[model samples]
Target: MASGKKRGKKPEVEFRNTQLADALQTQDMAAVAFALRHGPTVVPLMRPGARDDPRDTGEVWTFRDPKTGQVALLLFSDALHKPEAMPKAVGLHSPEWLRAFLEVHGDEITTVFFDIAGPHPMQASPADLIAALDA
Candidate 1:
C-alpha cells in the first residue's frame, strides 16, 4: 500500500554575529580576524528575477570599480546592517563558504570591505584575508 504524506517545512537558520559586530565597532583587527575565521558572514545576493522559490540562494553581490576595473567583495557581520543600495537579498554563509569564495575569487577581488557603507568601515587585501582564513 502507498501512503501520501507531505514533509513539514524545515527550520530556518538564524543569522547573527556578535563577535564580528563588536569587533567592527572597536576596530579590533585581531578580533575581526578571529571572528571571520570562526563566525558566519552576511553576503548580499543578486537574483535573475523575482524570487519564485524559497530555496533559492542567489549569486553573491560584488562591486567593480569603473576606473581600475577592480572588484571588491563586501562582507557584513549582520544581515540587518546591509545598506539599501545593495541587493535586497542576503544570505548567511559559514566560514567554509568564506574560505571557498576567497580561494575562487581571490584573483579577481583586489580588496575586501567589512561593513563597507558606514559605522567603522574596514578594508583588507584579498591576500591578507586568505592568510587569515588559512590561519
Candidate 2:
C-alpha cells in the first residue's frame, strides 16, 4: 500500500548579524574580515536556478551559529567593486588554508556562499554544506 502524507514545515530560523551588515553597508574589507574572524559559522549556498557549470559566478555563503541558531547571507562579487579594483583571486580554494580557517575561525564568517555576480541576496537554512565543511 502507498501512503500520501505531507511533511510538516520546519520552524523558521532568522539570520542576523549587525556587525556584518554594517561592514557590508560601509564596504569595508577590513571590517568584513574582522566580522568573519569573530562572528559566526558560514556555509556556502549555490545560486538558485543556476546551471551546474564548472565556471564560477556570484558566490554566496551563509553564516550561522549552532548555539544561537543565527544565520546571515554573505555575498561576494567583483561587481561590488570598481573595475580596476575588482578582486583578482581568492585563496579559499586552497585546502590547507581552508581547513586551517574553518578549524580556527569557523564560527565568525558572516556569509555562507561566495558569489561573483550582483544583487541576489537571499536567506537559506543550514544543511549538509556545513557538515562538508566540518569534514
**Top-scoring candidate (TM-score):** 1
lDDT value, residue 40 of candidate 2? 43
Model 1 residue 96 CA deviation in Å: 0.8
lDDT string, candidate 2, 31-77, tens digits: 55554444442223344223475344335334457888765443343
TM-score per prediction, in order, is: 0.81, 0.28
Q: How displaced is residue 27 in candidate 2, in Å?
A: 0.9
Question: Residue 43: error of model 1 in Å?
Answer: 0.4
Give the alpha carbon lDDT tens digit for every residue of 11-74 in model 1.
Answer: 9766668789898899888888899888898888885323586445568999999999999999
Q: Candidate 1: minimum summed lDDT over ten consecutive residues — where?
A: 48-57
Q: What is the C-alpha RMSD of each candidate to the true structure, in Å?
A: 4.3, 14.9
> Where in model 2 is the C-alpha error above 4 Å?
1-13, 45-135
